[model samples]
Target chain A: MSSNMMTEVLNLQANQLNAGASASLEAVLNAPPEARAELSALMKLAARMKRWLIPVRPSSAYRARLRDGLQLAAGHQETHRALVETRPRVPQWGWLIGAAALGSAAGIIAMILRRRQTRKDASVAESAR
Target chain B: MEAEEQLIERAKRDATAFGELYERYVDRIYNYIYYRVGNHADAEDLAARVFYRALGNIARYKQRGAPFAAWLYRIAHNLVANFHRDAARRREVPLDDIVAVAEKRAGPSQIAEQNEDARVVLEAMRALPAERQQIVILKFSEGLSNAEIGKLIGRSEGAIKSLYHRTLIALRAELVKRGAE
Candidate 1:
């Protein structure tokens, strides 16, 4: 990037950064898709490393006052958790019945084994007697 | 009315509406401040204050142009504006912290280049004015748009554009100077 162009880009980016939380993203979206992607990627990167520029506090009582706004911006810049939840589509009852049947079969086999062992023990005792 | 409108209208009259508004904007506001403030605890406290102030005086809100977010930004802006004066703050991201963050994300070596570049850019951002600093963080870091920005700070779209441009120019100059330094 030419010095002048780089300056403009930097200025534009700074302005965007300073534009507060309310600036129209549509304008940013209007940027060439490549530029948009590049800008976003750059922003994301800077955001992650921002902690170095700003002050960090232990997550505790003094939470409101920012010691360094810019650095804090960087540190807190992570992938934002989605505000809305997407419900996953659940499957039908086939798996549920199959699981239940499998569990029931295991229980029945366990019972049968216990009974056979008890009968074997009783028969051995009677023979000894 | 928009969702913001619904939210604000309900909040304007009722306490639960106020809570709902808090719920809606808390993370966004918290994110905005957390990135700029550089600490989780401070961001949370400031965010609570932002909602507290908003809730306390919600009756004064006049909704003609812009959504509820503008008012919120205004509150956030005003809050952060005073924050700088109260404390002497350093504006450099420590290298150790970057390594720590990278280690948590992936192998440190793979993300070294990305980490350094981001650190440079963040330092440049820290060099900007509070107004500009807050705006840039909110837009880029927190990912809010211009219309939302305007509503938060109570500016017209055109005004927001002009201010945004000016702030960018100022920031770019700072970044260049920092690079040279």
Candidate 2:
């Protein structure tokens, strides 16, 4: 059998052969003794491959540890999320507004002190004259 | 499956729900990693990382028409790949694990022979290219269909089938060489 035919036969066995493939694998497999032998060998190999890699369950202790770890992660994420939500949020423009308010207050206080000092200095000058 | 979807949605917000998802997929993921890595300790570590990563990123996970399990498997595939690359080494099946498997399958008289066969097969499997090894493990260990495997590996079903065929052929050749030895 051609390599393509063999591939077709194997693909059919795997159940993923393309819908539009021309040759029937069944016909090819049934045609000759040599083909039959090849099919048998391939099938046997497939079965062996399947059988050898048995499904192994993780240990119970490991399962419990994973469960604990996931629970911890979930808790961590929840806490982190809650902290983000409840933590006092300074609005994006809050700092700018606060800085402007402080600057204006400081300016007013400085102007008042300067005016008082100027008035006192003028009175002193007039008395000296 | 609808229930699972709801569970996944709940899991996105609920720790208990995420734990349930953990319970459901832990073994399958662990098994898949075990076969890929050929050991228990690394498998467990990688499997844990897969879940933690999943939980951390669950909020961003969308259905995307694939099952949640597929998402987990993809995480697992990536972790295993990194594990391999970082370790810069490939581990064959440990002899004790092979013996344990062989003991479970056959009588005492056949234990030695079965162990040998198991070792040979595992070595051959490890010798396969990374993607092909994954295909073999997903196909045989997880018992996933070609379409399902394709979904996991991002390949067309036809491509998966062809890969499987070639994998089997290479495996057979390896086994024949072992027998000759």
Candidate 3:
């Protein structure tokens, strides 16, 4: 048989083909003596593979430990979130400091302007006399 | 499926729900890892890590059309790969474990024959490529259908079918050689 034909037969025996296609292929496999032997061997191998299916489970202690670990992790996450939410916010000192500096500069400017106005008034009074 | 999704969503928020998920998938994940690592201790450690990692990232897990178990399998697969790489050695399935497994299912009259077959099969399986080994394990051990296996392995159903057929053929050849010996 061609490799494709062999692949098809093996695929059929793998039970991967659709129901209708599998039925026809099963007939084809059964019709030929060589194919029948091949199919038998495949079935035997399939049966042997089932020995691996003996469900091996982790120990009970292991399961308990895993559960505890997950709980601890979840608790830690919740605590961290709460801490973030409840922590006091630091005052923004930079903005306060900036406003103070601007106020000081405005006061200094006003004082300088007042002195200049007084000097100009004394000069005007002397000219009028 | 919808119920599982609701459990998963709850798991993201509730520890008890997550614990429920753990109970559901721990054995399947452990079995997958055990066969890959071929030892109980590493499998346990890796399985623990798999769940820890899953829980840590549970909030970020999106369904994406695959089951939550698929995500867990993917995590297990990566950790097992890393374990193999870090260990820099392929651990063969211990002969005793194979004998134990076979004896559990086979009668005393058939123990010797079944044991030998189990050993040969495991040895042959170890010789297969990692992906092929996974395919065989998922198909046989977990009893997952092709579509499920494909989702876990990131393969289409057709691709999995071809790989499985090839795997069986290789196993048959290996068994024949072992019998001849």
Minimal lDDT window, size 10, model 1 chain A: A75-84
Cα lDDT tens digits, model 2, A1-129, are: 676676667766544322323334465457477777756666666665666778888889888877987888789899999999999977779889999999999999999999999999999999999
* lDDT score at residue A6, model 3, on the 0-100 scale: 60
> How much does each candidate deviate from the true structure in C-alpha RMSD?
23.7, 7.1, 7.1
Per residue, candidate 1 scores C-alpha lDDT tens digits across B1-181 of 2477777877665555565565566656776675565545456667767876776567678888666766777787678767755667534445555554343465656679656665666666666776667666655555555566666666655566556556655665666677621
Score each candidate by Cα lDDT: 0.57, 0.79, 0.77
DockQ of all candidate complexes: 0.02, 0.36, 0.32
Ranking by TM-score: 2, 3, 1
lDDT of 1 by residue, A1-129 (tens): 233433344335544544443233453465565566544444433333233333332332233233243223322321122222344657769999999999999999999999999999999999999
lDDT of 2 at B141: 76
What is the TM-score of model 3 when looking only at chain B?
A: 0.83
In order, the candidates keep a fraction of the true contacts of 0.04, 0.65, 0.51
Chain B, model 1, TM-score against the native? 0.75
Q: How do all models score by TM-score? A: 0.52, 0.76, 0.72
Off by over 4 Å in 1: A1-129, B1-3, B88-105, B110-113, B144-148, B155-166
